[model samples]
Target chain A: MSNTQGNLNTTAEVGIVEDGGSFPPFDSTTYPSQLLWLVLSFGVFYWVMSKVVLPRIGGILEDRRDRIAGDMAEASRLKQETDEAIASYESALAEARKKATTMAHDARSKVKAETESARAAAEEQLAAKLSESEQSISKITAESLSHVGEIAAETTGELVKALIGGRAPAKAEVAKAVDAALK
Target chain B: MAGNSGNAIDPIHQFHISKIFPVEIGGVDFSFTNASLFMVVTVAVATLFLVLSTNRRGLVPSRAQLMAEMSYEFVAATLRGSAGNDGMRFFPLVFSLFMFVFVANMLGMFPYFFTVTSQIIVTFALAILVIGTVTIYGFFKHGAGFLKLFVPSGVPAGVIPLVSAIEVISFLSRPVSLSVRLFANMLAGHITLKVFAGFVVMLTGFGAVGVASAVLPLILTVAITALEFLVAFLQAYVFTVLTCMYLADALHPSH
Candidate 1:
């Protein structure tokens, strides 16, 4: 490979050269055989690359693409389901809340209605008891006033009998006089 | 070899074409040369790299598998971007071309190894195949309208013929430029390195002065060698992208 072999390389120039003719690169003798080899080698590599290597890489890429698409689709579906679930859950909670509010309102109204009716009934019972007691008290007061009048007239007769000795007024006459006085 | 005879260090001599095994049929030489051996080696290495790296074909890639997938995606993306999804049909061709050229150029970087891409005939053959495929695809797909590729739509009536002629000439010169670009780059870089290496060898004489003088060429040789490796990969990329553009033209004849 050393270029000191003067007899071997005569066209080697010191600086950059242009197109070559006398150099081996310009040789036309080996064109056909080299071409034949090129064709064979190129054919083999082409078959391997197109049929084997490229297809494998393409398959990998396609697989990754499919996998990503599948994942995205799955994620979106799960999101939709989750959203639906949330919506249903919220609706159920709202329904429960509405039902509980109605029940509480009904219980409050029931308790209020019961309290009002009970107070009205207790007040009626108290008014009836008061009227009965007031009638009994008036009757007792009338009977006691008659007793006092009788006692006053009887005591007056006894006083007259003691004072006038044997000259006491008749019982009937005395009652008539007492009655007039009471009127 | 670098003595007074001055016959040992000839940079161009390394590219000499010689038959490793001599064969002749119909007065035509079909003999295998060092170039053929390296071509096989190129094929072997390229094929082996892909086949072994992909033998497992696991989801989590090893380094080799990553390398394999990277090259595959690199060419695939280039073709797809340049020619659209339909260009995927030509993925195998583009991938093979990239790998072959890249491996051949890299192999040439080693000592005592032949660079197949440095040859005009080899690069010319590949270029012709690409151009031929593009032309055939254009005609097959678009029929007679494929010729419209040579005529721009907005040219004035007076300048149409002149513009058409220039465009047609440019279009036809694609293969020449394509092949020459890679061949010339490889040829110039390798020849420069050989020349500089020869200078280093030649300067070993004259005692201290020779030693001091050899240092410059040695540094330059190192720098140029590094630059050449970069050029090797760059040329391969340029060739592949250009091929994709041509393929694009084939698919979309208007562009």
Candidate 2:
């Protein structure tokens, strides 16, 4: 449609020459193309960014992520180890406490058992002493009684004999008296 | 063959870059020309786009803001996907470059518009700048350590020098290679379009039979024009991406 309008101007009539001059010299006849320069400049800058700057920045970011991940993992591992250590410590402490209480209970029971055995031994010693004292008392009492009997009998006989000498007729009376006393 | 139009100026002469500066210094020809003017215009337009897009302050961007956002996003995404998050920072440069070249290319599709990029000097200059920046950046960041980039880690020491020398040569050749790729593609596409267009005009200008024959050329022109549009955009995109890759090399100094 635009071509039908005959918009091909003076420049359009000219054809591209392969062997065109080395470069355009500054002149009205040969003007620089704005679009070309724009494209060229853009191309250059883009090339620099894509080629040089972008990759390094990427590397740095990648490095940062890696570092952060590594640090976090290390910290987590360390924390886990610490938690295990604490749990083990508490368990050990609880075990020790349990053992201590068991030991205390056993000691108290031993003390109570020793006290009961000591009390039984003391009771047996007391019973033996009481029996021996009773035996001695009985023996002493028997000896005293026998001595008194002997003394009394001898005195009576002597009296009787004196009375009989004074009077031969009294012999029957003395024998009767002895018999009554015996009865 | 349509009889030669006796008054027709040599069509090829139109492409000449007539000297504006009749002077030379140290064997270097520095001259202002149409190609230079277009370069200035491209830069000005690019700057204008950036300034206009960002000038207004808004929590929610308006149409212009959206346009600006999309442009940056498109370029940034492409760079990031190709390069990485690190490339995101270089969004402005890549985006601008793509826009400038793309706009220039589209503009040239217009009948009268000049294609400055069609010139080797313009393309070469741009390529040189990229290469130079990459080299400079590598040395600045890595110091002498940048040399190690060519030494591929894990390689045997016996072959180190040989490998490094090869790497250096290839690296040094980047600018020329880059310049030629863009220049060659643009030059070829434009020339083909022009020749086809010429055929359409000349053939149809003859009798009815000529016009019927001209239909084939016209159809071809239409197809070429559409294809050219794609080519224009593609070339720009390819050029920009390649530049980014080269810069990546410099930043990391990879062998």
Candidate 3:
């Protein structure tokens, strides 16, 4: 390879006699080609980057950003909905608690009122029975006293008949005697 | 042939251009050469890497896609940082320049491969392209107001001419510095690596002691090669960064 390179350099030296063994970079003969190719190649590169490569990457990045934003929005919306649901559920629980308390209070008061009325009715019936019994006892006592008086009068008349033979007392006199004894 | 020759440790020999297919057009030698071949290879490799990586366009990006995206965002961020969002208009140009230079530099790191960016004309051409874009776009966008780039806003009236002159000179030197920085770095790094490698080769010509002593230069060569790799990436970055700054000047010329 070195020998070939040597040969090539000899040939290049012979072909380009004007180069005069100057530094390759400073050699102006190669500038036109280098510049030409640079322009052409760089031009093509610029075109590809601008027209094809950049847009594709840009589009991908934009799409990813949009998707992330959309996902975040959805998550936030769902969270809001969940918060609303929780709020409504709490309110409903509070309402139910209030209603149950009211119902229990009403039932307690109604039971108390029914018990009071029943107790009052029973007391009134007992009082009426006591008064009726008192009235019957008083009547029976009066009747028994009248019978005792009659018996007393009969006994007095028998004794008189026995003592004074054949002397009968008058009915009016007997009634008067009996009435005085009773008095 | 130069490698076989005992004392022929000519580092410049690697840079020599040879015609692969000689052709004449209008009496000018437009022959395809090794430099041209490498340029085409750089373009092909860069294109393939970019295109194939994004072929799937997966929302969940693959590794190659991630790499492609990183490169895009990296360049994009640099431009946006210096030139603002408006500089994105020149994204294609900037991206192309970066990829071409970076890939060309990386490919040249291979043994026996031709380095396209080592040529001054090529780097000069790219620098001119950047400066040309800046000048043309500056004038087109800002008209004569673009000249305000030379006139800083808060300068005293006394030194306005001096400041403007300095600004003009600096602006003019942008291309020269841009091109030379990259070209010199590559040239010097390669030459240094070649010279150190030549030391290792030359030392091995001695007996057992020479082979043992070659270890030092060999180690240095390895270290220099690593440094060259870093420089390869760095030069590309520096070139693109300057390009972005210049474009920024074009975008907003008033200091």
Superposed on the true chain A, the predicted chain A of model 2 yields a TM-score of: 0.52
Question: Poorest 10 consecutive residues of model 2 chain A by lDDT?
Answer: A4-13
State the displacement of the C-alpha of residue B38, model 1, in Å, after optimal TM-score superposition.
1.8
Pick by TM-score: 1 or 2, better one: 1
* Residue runs of model 3 more than 4 Å from their true location after superposition: A1-21, A119-183, B1-3, B6-8
Query: What shift in Å separates residue B234 of candidate 1 from its native position after superposition?
Result: 2.4
| Clash list (residue pairs), candidate 3 | A2-B1
Which is better, 1 or 2, measured by DockQ?
A: 1
**DockQ, computed on Cα atoms, for candidate 2:** 0.06
Instruction: List CA RMSD, all candidates.
Output: 5.9, 13.4, 5.1
Better of 1 and 3 by lDDT: 3
Q: How close is candidate 1 to the true structure, as a TM-score?
A: 0.74
Q: How high is each candidate's TM-score?
A: 0.74, 0.55, 0.82
Q: Model 2, range B65-156, lDDT digits (tens) per residue?
A: 56655665667667777767765555656665677677677766776456666666666767776777677877988888777777888889
Ranked candidates (TM-score, high to low)? 3, 1, 2
